[model samples]
Target chain A: MEIELNDSKHTRNSWMERFETYLPEVVYGSIDGIVTTFAVVAGAAGAELQINIILILGMANLFADGLSMSIGSYLSNKSERDNYQKHLHIEEWEIENMPDDERKEIEMIYRQKGFEGKELEMVVNRITSNKKVWLDTMMKDELGLSEQKKSPLKAGLSTLVAFITAGAIPLAAYILAYAGKYQIDPFILSSLVTVFAFILIGYIKTYVTQIGLLRSILETLLLGAAAAMAAYFLGDYLEKLLV
Target chain B: MEIELNDSKHTRNSWMERFETYLPEVVYGSIDGIVTTFAVVAGAAGAELQINIILILGMANLFADGLSMSIGSYLSNKSERDNYQKHLHIEEWEIENMPDDERKEIEMIYRQKGFEGKELEMVVNRITSNKKVWLDTMMKDELGLSEQKKSPLKAGLSTLVAFITAGAIPLAAYILAYAGKYQIDPFILSSLVTVFAFILIGYIKTYVTQIGLLRSILETLLLGAAAAMAAYFLGDYLEKLLV
Candidate 1:
């Protein structure tokens, strides 16, 4: 049992931790990428545009939206870490410059946590004896912050990779139609593959959400279909009206 | 200080808690709503469709997407709460049916927390003495779950309201042009107002993210513009290709 536990721990430390950290970004990018790119394809198809036009519009939307999303992700993550670091520095400065006040604040916090008299003093002494532990306690108990930092660049890269990978699925048929000798109706083929992409995304989401497979797939499919339908009908109506 | 604290506490109990609880849903709905509805408007305008067509398409996309988002939010929230509750019930059953094993588990948990011998036994006894507290401790410490439950219906309603309110901003100018004797081009007016809407969302986001006002606004504007530009250019290219 001990050996098995250690083996699992070793595996988790190596790869599982990284996977868990960036799973949210991957899910976000994948869903957004597939939905928006397919919406472009649907709209072009509804306007009775050629397969080449669908490929052009779909690819453009995929890369542009992916880049925009990644940049947004990078900026937000960087700013959040900066804010946390700023607070951390302020706390460290307070600890060094005004040790007496910092000690009092620690006592006050533990007192509120139900320790009192000698017990409170002992707890405070135990924590404040080590500068690192003191700083960590203040950061968590007083400011309610955690030090689980992540890299902004890696976050952005994960988003871009996930977006491009999932977003490209919708355009597979259109690209094939433009490139290969296969005579399948590109729009129909695109719709079919897009459905498969939605299912894949939905299955991945189940890992985080703990929802039933059928329910997640149903919700994703319905949402994607609605977006595509709206775009398609709008395009068709506009084409009839003006073209 | 006493009076100020009491007054603030009173205010928080009445409304602040609710605001904090549903703020995430509001932000989600508001951002998605504005970005998507404006994309529809941009696409229609790029196709040189009339104001009525733009209005029709924009409104349709707004309501349809809003409904889909709210429904998605509702199901996910409901499923998460359900999963938590299921685990809670299982924990309760184990405590009732196998108290010795549960007690041993509690001791193991506290012992791992640095308590030893008598101290560990005391801590475990203190926790498992009260059924509710014991259950809560097991839920939090053992299973790493929190009982911060939320009503799924209220969450869905909040999402729907935010989506409609924020999403309607981009269509405001178009609606005015259709009803009033306005001389301004509706598309230009829409572009202007949508920028304002983006700024508003960005400003609200700063309250949660603690990022600088300028940076948040710039990020939101860039993302919105990118989506709108992609939609518009795609529509324009398709129109030229087919028409």
Candidate 2:
């Protein structure tokens, strides 16, 4: 294989790599976001809010959470890349000035791997003679610096977009699908569909996380249950006291 | 100053580097997990659940979410290390068998970097003289493999155990502190405290995310509001309807 790492090449494929890195999160995140959003809308509708109010809650969640996820992903990646570059610059400068000391380090490395006598010396001499080859080797083997840098733009765009799109599906299901089904209170049907979405979202987590399919599905279902149970009991007690 | 890039003598403090690497996430994840748990407990209490029940919900959330986060971090890192190892094995075999091809690849690499004539040939001859040196050069420069593989068990355990610990804080606060208030009316005080934690978590997102802090805080707060509001309403209706 070719010697010397190409930083620029890595930069070129960064967007593609970032997309690949984020692929798993997108599907799983969408399911989670959608389920959570549905829970909010359904809960509101159950509490007897207007249809418009339920929709407003869904929209607000979509926008707000999307923005937060986007920004968080962006900043974390940027800082990590910044840290990498800072170290790289120093490593580059070291190669330019201290060739002798650097060569000694190479000789020792070969020594550790069972090289000895003139063979070790010759190997170190050859590698150290070339500055570019030496520095690239140190960066890769010693520093563990890889070509992967998380892209802020890709992260921000993907997460925000995913959240919005996923969040919308449940809202749409509640409005178009649920409202059509109920001959009585249109909103009641909406609640059922919304709760159903939570279970589905929880189930999706198993695939993304390799969490047992049964456990993931059940755990997510419990989140919904806990939410509903907490709300209902509090509402029941508060209704008694407030009235 | 070392002119050689393969220098192994790094003067930088290892402890400092490690501390910097992990400290921020530790603080962020711990505080954030606890705060989130607090909010859930508070909202549950506000819905007027008994103190014991509110405590149960908060405890459940803390353990569940914390475990989930820890497991995710472990698996993802392990997969990355595994993938890197696979690439490294291929490079190792290539170095062992195809000296001529590997030498050509090295020459091709430096040629692209603007080496030519006698100087280029000298550099290639010097690097390829020892196969180990050649292999080292190729692995570092071309393949981008690092020697450090953070133990999967350690990372996983740290995240999972830390999350669970952090998650416990809010539950403790609800059970011991808030539950004692209002003659042990566990729900309202717990929810109010939870909203406070949510507000705090939102505010931290600014620092955590490196974005418009106000927007981040606002978004998180909205999520808290919607979750609590939905729980109250949906729980109310579901309880009545189920009966």
Among all candidates shown, the one with the greatest lDDT: 1
The sequence of per-residue lDDT tens digits that candidate 2 reaches over residues A120-220 is 67556666666666765555555665643446677667766776777776567445633465355554554565566656665655555555667666655
Every candidate's lDDT: 0.73, 0.55
Model 2 TM-score, all chains together: 0.56
Report the C-alpha displacement of residue A200, candidate 2, in angstroms: 13
**Clash counts for the predictions, in order:** 0, 17
Candidate 2, B111-220: lDDT as tens digits: 65556776567667766776556765676556654443466656656665655665565565555654353464444545556567656656655554444657656655
What level of docking quality does candidate 1 show?
incorrect
lDDT of 2: 0.55
| Candidate 1 interface RMSD value | 5.7
Residue-by-residue lDDT tens digits, candidate 1, A31-135: 777877777777666667667545555655566567666866787788778778888889899999999999988887655544567656766776677677678
Q: DockQ for candidate 2, please give it.
A: 0.10
